[model samples]
Target: MNLGIIGQAAGLYAVTNIDDILVLALFFAQGAGHKNSTRNIALGQFLGFAAILAVAVAAAYGATFLPGSAVPYLGLLPLALGTKAAVQAWRHRGDAEEEKQAGEGGPKPLEVAAVTFANGGDNIGVYVPVFATAGIGGMSAYVIVFLALLAVWIAAGRYFATRPVIAKALSRWGHILLPLVLIGIGVLILIEGGAFGL
Candidate 1:
């Protein structure tokens, strides 16, 4: 039982990392002013996290297999996403400046959901490790971690969504930066994946 508790604690510790914070911040910022979209993102993230959990458990339990060394391949996901973001940014470069003057056109529910899903791609991988570590014995611990993360995630979203200046600035620069941010994260993952010779 004590070992189970320890396992749970370890899982929680792993999931609540700096990466999670940054990802949460990006998602929150993107969701600002779009309640339905934020809701969808939250739901998507939760579901995505759950799916990763299942995959992680399968890897651990032998329903699937990957050498720990192969985990780095996940880096490709972020890299691809980041590159896509960069391309999108490039494609919409002119629109970005024009949109600033035009102001937020209107609430875009579907677009918000798509953006949320894209932002969530990286997070899904993060959850995989947590689930693999937590396992059936540590389900409670995983739930606790999930709830804690969810609270902070939603609160961050709410706080930023309500801030006029922050919202305005994000509205203006978000298009320009989101792709770059994704690209940076992708590069970081690739570097980390290779740094120790993954």
Candidate 2:
């Protein structure tokens, strides 16, 4: 289950059509060989990822320190968060549409990082098992997962930047649908939690 969650974090970036990749690639390409927007985005994503890793690791380790009965509540954290995100996305469909229009005006680096953070939110739930397990080398597992995610992110970014048809479509509907899909995923996680009696 934990591996599934971690793999989702990595795979989601790759499965999205080439459009997201191009936008991200353009971010990096514009910043080519100098301090540019893409560099900032890369920096932001790295820092954001670091923040996520810290939180996930802490969650895992802390769970080990807590009583057995407390584990279920901790397990509920991701489900609750995912549910809330889904609800927010559903409620803010208009905002998403507006943002799509506004996105044409300019690219935002911080926004990229924000999106990256949102994309990675599921990591929290995946860490619970790692933190609770002793001598399982949680750090090693994190490294493996991070490397996998990085590869997928880079490949997708490059592919979309080079492709036109895929890019156009992604620009049109990616923002609108990505959140809905995430919400569905969150609900699925929540259901899984319920099954575990969390």
Model 1: weakest 10-residue lDDT segment is 100-109
TM-score, one value per model = 0.64, 0.46
lDDT tens digits by residue: candidate 2, 1-198: 277546753553344322334445644432333335445656555665565566666676663333444323332433443354445445655665555344333224554554444445555456556545633554555456665666566556646644677546654554444444434444444454453553
| lDDT, model 1 | 0.54
In candidate 1, clashing pairs total 0
- Per residue, candidate 1 scores C-alpha lDDT tens digits across 118-184 of 3344454555665566667675566565556655665666576457887677666765555576666
Each prediction's whole-model lDDT (CA): 0.54, 0.49
Residue 110 displacement (Å), model 1: 12
Clashes of each: 0, 3
Candidate 1 TM-score versus the reference: 0.64
lDDT score, candidate 2: 0.49
Candidate 1 wrong stretches, greater than 4 Å: 1-15, 31-35, 96-137, 195-198
Most accurate candidate by lDDT: 1
Output the number of the TM-score-best candidate.
Answer: 1
